[model samples]
Target chain A: MLTTAPTAVGDDAALALWVLHELHYRGFAGVDDGLEWEPTLLQVRGLLEADLERRLRGRWTPPQGLSFVDDALEWIDGQDGVSLARHVHRDADRDQVLDLLRVRSLYHLKESDPVSWLVPRLGVPAKAALMELQFDEYGNGDPNRLHHHLFATGMAAAGLEPSYDAHVDVVPLEVLEQNNTLSLFGLHRRLRGAALGHLAAFEATSSLPSRRMAEGLKRLDLPPEIIAYYAEHVEADAVHEQLAVRTIAAALLDEEPDLEADLWFGAFTCLDLEDRFARRMLDRWGVGEVAA
Target chain B: MSEPGVAFEHPDVVLCPGGPMLLRGRHTVEDADGVPHETTRPVTAVCRCERSASFPWCDGTHKVLPPKLRPA
Candidate 1:
């Protein structure tokens, strides 16, 4: 039987969902893979996902009188959110940057894996577009070019543990919530629209910020590998941003016009989660104002 | 889809207003300085703003430029 939604996705609740979701990915050592479909655990996962969905939707205000596909890029640009990128660009110290890399690894290590779940859920136009974007994300047939591996190599060069889940225990609620949101959108077939929406927002924000991050790494005199990892994003995400917003997202909306609201919700969630994450980190670092 | 049962088809050219012109497939593009840059990725954005730091490839700098200053 499903327990009532936890008052909020507090630490225990978050961890419960995290463990349950991990079953779908790389299951724990000695854990039966069949547990992925266990009724009791799935019920709990369902409840948590419902709660997360409600929380996210409650915060979103879907754009009005506008074509979401045509206007999304400009809409995202107009929003003023606290920027962790700007902080890293100008003032963050070495430890601060390293801390960010560790926290970011929670998502970066599995980069693009969440959205990959949408592949089978889409029609030809959207599916083909998504694959085109994902093909690059997965390194265009070269393991050396794979984004997560690139991050891992960069992390090792920075003297941090590049192993999977090495920093999960230390990440804050904000970080966990961010990862949870990504997984939540991806895992549900019903939320495939939101998944691509998140991808569009993510790619849109990445290119310039990657440039800033690269510059910041240079400022800290960090190793060349670390800087190169970010430098790669500058050009890569520029291409991805266009493909995501124009091709992937546009094609999806074309096929399923009713998904417009869900798309906005997902896009809003992406920016909102990052805003919250940035605020938490900036406050922790005693830096500039966090976006409200 | 580029018609049913068509094994080979997709947009080879896409133009993003106020951004860059997306060129897909294997081709070489020459910068104004007469340097040829090969299109390595499936889709490459050739800078239209003429202000890109990496000539012949967009670095997303057009976003920072004013609407009037961006490509017309």
Candidate 2:
């Protein structure tokens, strides 16, 4: 049944994986939830996930010189990709920014849900630290303050649809791959290391990019509610990055050193997928990379 | 961390190498301008790199700074 489906890391493969993963998140309108557990579908999912994993790992070569933290930071510094946020900040037209926002809403609308799956899978220090980070992602018990809700509100304020998966059809292949990678890591017990690694890398990259996004939104004359979403991230992610890396990721690795490679895999995938997404968007816009 | 039951209590303040100082719990911090910034979240990252556009709080601009310029 899966013979015709592409098994590589390109658009067709990612699209198939995305659809399969979506069943586990919020099923398609006409699709039965039972299909989420159907053997044939699960088989395809496994194959696609394996392909994606192979593709992600193919790009990573373990750093030889620096400490893990320094290596990770240097990994990001060494990445040579277009900065979509910088372009948005300095030159994107209103339509382009809005298009990017629509694509981004695919993930922002469900922020932190994937990583929350790791809370129960962890031990003490990692568990507590992850919870501390998640508590903020969950809005400190205030529904209105929830990060995803914040994104929803921002989407509405910007005159875009805020419903979950509202922009899936409009999102590019890279976005699909990005979301798939996170969901894949979060769903597997064996991949817990990768999940937190992805979390740390994600939080590390978020704060500054969020600031650029906030400025870009402000420049576009978007509503304050929209700006507030990015504004909130600028602070939240700064705290979260430290919590994820120094506290959560470190604690996990200290207990299970065997998972170091997978941890690095997840982090590299996080940066790599984002770079692909940024490059795709910039190429589509025919915009050159802005100075970092 | 492998010691199972050993307590790993959250420190009130964590000095992240080359990054921010994470202050846990509540406190009011005075920035260079002498204005007080209240702790709104359960944990806050105070800008040690001093390049945060948010002033007292980190906005993550430290990542853009040269490694030598980042806080030790």
Error of 1 at A23 (Å): 1.4
lDDT of each: 0.86, 0.85
How high is each candidate's TM-score?
0.95, 0.93
Question: lDDT tens digits, residues A60-99, model 2?
Answer: 8876654455456556656665578788877899999999
The reply for model 1, stretches above 4 Å from the true place, is A6-9, A290-292, B1-9
Write the residue-wise lDDT of candidate 2 on B1-72 in tens digits.
Answer: 547666666789989888889999999998778988899899999999888889799888888899899999
For every candidate, the chain B TM-score is 0.83, 0.87
DockQ, all models = 0.56, 0.69
Best by DockQ: 2
**Deviation (Å) of A121 in candidate 2:** 1.6
User: Residue-wise lDDT of candidate 1 within A1-292, one digit each (tens)?
Assistant: 6578756547677777777888887778889999999998899889988887888889988888877778888888877788888888888999999999999997888899988888999988889899988998888999998999899999999999998778988888888888888999999999988888888888888888888899999999899888888888887888988888888888888778888888888888999999988988998988878332
lDDT of residue A74 for candidate 2: 55
Candidate 2 clashing pairs, residues 3+ apart or interchain:
none
Query: Lowest-lDDT window of 10 residues in candidate 1 chain A?
Result: A1-10
